[model samples]
Target: MKKLLAMLLVICSTASAEIQPEPIGRIQTLPDPYPPHWIVAVDVAFFHMNDGKLIVLDADSDDPAGRFKGMMNGTFIPVMYMAETRPEIYVLESFRARGHRGERTDVMTIYDKTTLAPIDEVVIPAKRVSAMPTEYYLQLVDDEKLALIYNFTPATTVSVVDLEKREFLGEVPIPGCSLIYPLAGRAFASLCGDGKLLTIQLDRNGKLVSSERTEAFFDADNDPLMEKPAIIDGIAYFPTFLGNVFPVDLSGSAPVIGESWSLVEGVEGGWRPGGIVLAQGDASGRLYVLMHPDGHDGTHKDPGSEVWVFDPQTKQRVDRIELALPAITMGLTNDDDPLLVTTNINLEVDVYNANSGEHLRTIGNFGQETVFLFHSDR
Candidate 1:
């Protein structure tokens, strides 16, 4: 009996051995890529819309002072929308101003990064309904091909384009969904005028093999902040306007929504949750959920918001950072960098230490005003 117990103990110990997955490195370049030393990409508000330009700011020059000074004054963009290689930037333009009267045509300009000059300009096709400014999110799946999501209703379609030849490979119809976010060889999209999330998969022949509804919303007509699903560690994090966060597991035979997280912890619960960013360091641990207190009136106007950070591992609310100004959008600087909140107040981006809610740096209207990307030089 004693000898049998010893063998069982040994078997249990071996079963407990943990197999760790590789950490995803800081996203440096896209599939086929080239990037400058500093300033990965800046999303700026151009032509009155969120259409921003990507400017390269490198101070490691013969004349550091001169190079630094030159950055303050925007440089001519080689690419409009920052992509993988030859095309570093793709700027989707909108001619008409919001609430402005009448129809208008627009052009999307592509630029090269090294030279900061225009490479190609294509006219964005008009939509049947009232048009709004949207980005043509492009992903270079491989060396020769790219997955492109053209933004515009009626004209909205996901297609594969030949990078070398700029040839239209083919377009796949995404009914009910208007926005397509391409990541990890699959596209996660949300139905237009609805909060339902859908998953689209493409086979080797570039044909969209299966399209399935991943998650349905609480309300059919409710606009759920309309943001891209954060895909991290093979798990897609979906934070809804209703203060719910879904961590979907993709490792299984079929992807399943593992856990539902509530950002604001209270008897009544949180609402209008936006800007959900994943925590760094300990893998499969914490996730930061930014909540906007726009009490269910359905109008998205909120005065001053608070970010409630939660630890998924512990399944608890970690901390809260009250923003003096109302946050328009939020992002991260480093893997461990604090939450970078962008406010419409001063159009400034403030960085807070993720854990302690300490203000690190307010990268004020230093570069771009809108949704900005913070990359670590470390």
Candidate 2:
């Protein structure tokens, strides 16, 4: 009887040891030939307020690899990828505290690019502009040494954070100006409400070195310039609501406003440059703009039916790419086979060959309204 009980115990132990439990999820190593281009799409949810997400897509394979979805206070949170020293991403967004309508806390969260794991977060004290997408609201300066965050708590200001040290330095007050365009050296330029360009020079510690404002440059009320400017070689080309291109030279100590040029000379009537990302400049010094026909007084926010490529140096139209669908926003990749991506009215990203202007493919359903398409290489 003792020998039988011992044999049964041994058999049970051996069987239990052989039947090892498998891991819940296995980590598989990826093969070679990874996707080349990466596309970052921001899904701005108006109905489900807390369901906004920053989705990352592989352009070559057209697959969504990773995404970050959370409660955000506003509609215009921005994400920036830092690919210099390490693979990391920075997102400037706000979160609700106790309740949905409770106190808001603004933060800059850093995430690992590979694993999509959060690394660190720095709290920002100032309230950011939440209504519209401000292009330069959060801009990196001095080769990622400092991070400039634009704030608008009924007053315009910029909060400078030392990215290298991972600390918030302080806020620089630009009373009447908004937006930030990093100039040469440790300075930045802002567009003022009074139709002037405000240039502010900041030291390493986020202190103001010097500040100056240019004379009233353009008419702000009737023909206000678009927020996103195509900056090339220290020159910012701003497109107005009336299809006028305004160039400002920021290479020197101050901003030098150049003569304004028209973008619609030979085109028929009721045509104007309009869209979220209306204008973008390429590496070859060519400018791409979205144009729409039958534009009215407040039609600057309308979707564009065509894309017009122009040589800003010669101020002449080079190529016109007609779109199958009206685009509200557009972006371009910096690869050899550059792709011109446009977000249509149905929130689908229509890809096209930038050189030949041939339609490639449409990538996205995203499960929400995608407002912007930012290329990693661009």
Candidate 3:
């Protein structure tokens, strides 16, 4: 009896030992250079603004495990720009002295793509805009050597940062203008409150060289253009509160405001372009705009039901893409053959064939409220 009891104990011990512990202190690294379809989804976390996030994932991957590559957290409302020439990701973010609020602090964090770890940080003015996420709020110019940050301390200004030196270049004041659009060589154009395009040029040393404003291009109070614009081949395609396309040719040293065209010229059901990130222009200069029905007052920021494609040469919509779900924001992956990515009302990232407009795959359980999508071909 004693021998049998001892043997039972030995058997139980052997079984317990076979269960291996999870590997500890293991670090995983993503692909050095990610695939073309990989996108960084921005989670502004509206309900919980301080704890924001930027999720990087493979838009084309079917498996969820394979799709999610990496992520980084933000202290406050933040905007990110992926560097083309450098292996770094720039995040213009803010922090509070305490947990939620105290003294405010803003900084541009330089993160390494491989480790997804913040490698460097540059202190900037604490007056960064604290509203919805927009790529225009933060832009990279001067061959990615200088980053322009749009500030709305109620007073509009652009904070220039020397990317190579990692220092804060002087802030250029544009009294009534906001948003930043990279224009011809070392220059940026901003949309003004009085319906003008303010172009601010920078010297080789990242200093203000010259600035000018074009005549009133669009009606600001009546039918304002969405701050979001699809800049393709040196031209920005801005969609108005209605369904008009306002093109600003940034190909030259100064902006040339082109003629406007109605997108819903012959359409019905009150169709209009609306959403957070509603516009996208591909390498071929084709415009992809998010559209919906039953447009009304204050519905300019509503989610979209379809994507209207347009031919720049003809200034006419060529194709209309019906979405599987209502999308709040949209973006395009920069591949030889691009893919249109959109965030549905449920915060699921939907992938579609840019050319065919076919629903490829939908990525659910991505993030809590993805407000923006970032993907680049270059």
By TM-score, who's the top model here?
3
Count: clashes, candidate 1: 17
Runs in model 3 with CA error above 4 Å?
1-25
Candidate RMSDs in Å, in order, are 18.1, 6.3, 4.2
Would you list the C-alpha lDDT of every candidate in the order shown?
A: 0.48, 0.75, 0.86
lDDT tens per residue, model 2, 117-181: 56787888847777556457777767678888888888889988888777888899998999988
lDDT score, candidate 3: 0.86
TM-score of each: 0.63, 0.86, 0.91
Model 3's TM-score against the true structure:
0.91
- The superposed Cα distance between candidate 2 and the true structure at residue 186, in angstroms, equals 1.5
Candidate 1 at residue 258, lDDT? 66
lDDT of 1 by residue, 181-249 (tens): 444554444354454556666665567777777556435455353344454565656666566666666
Q: How far off is residue 172 in model 2, in Å?
A: 0.7
**N/CA/C clash count, model 2:** 0
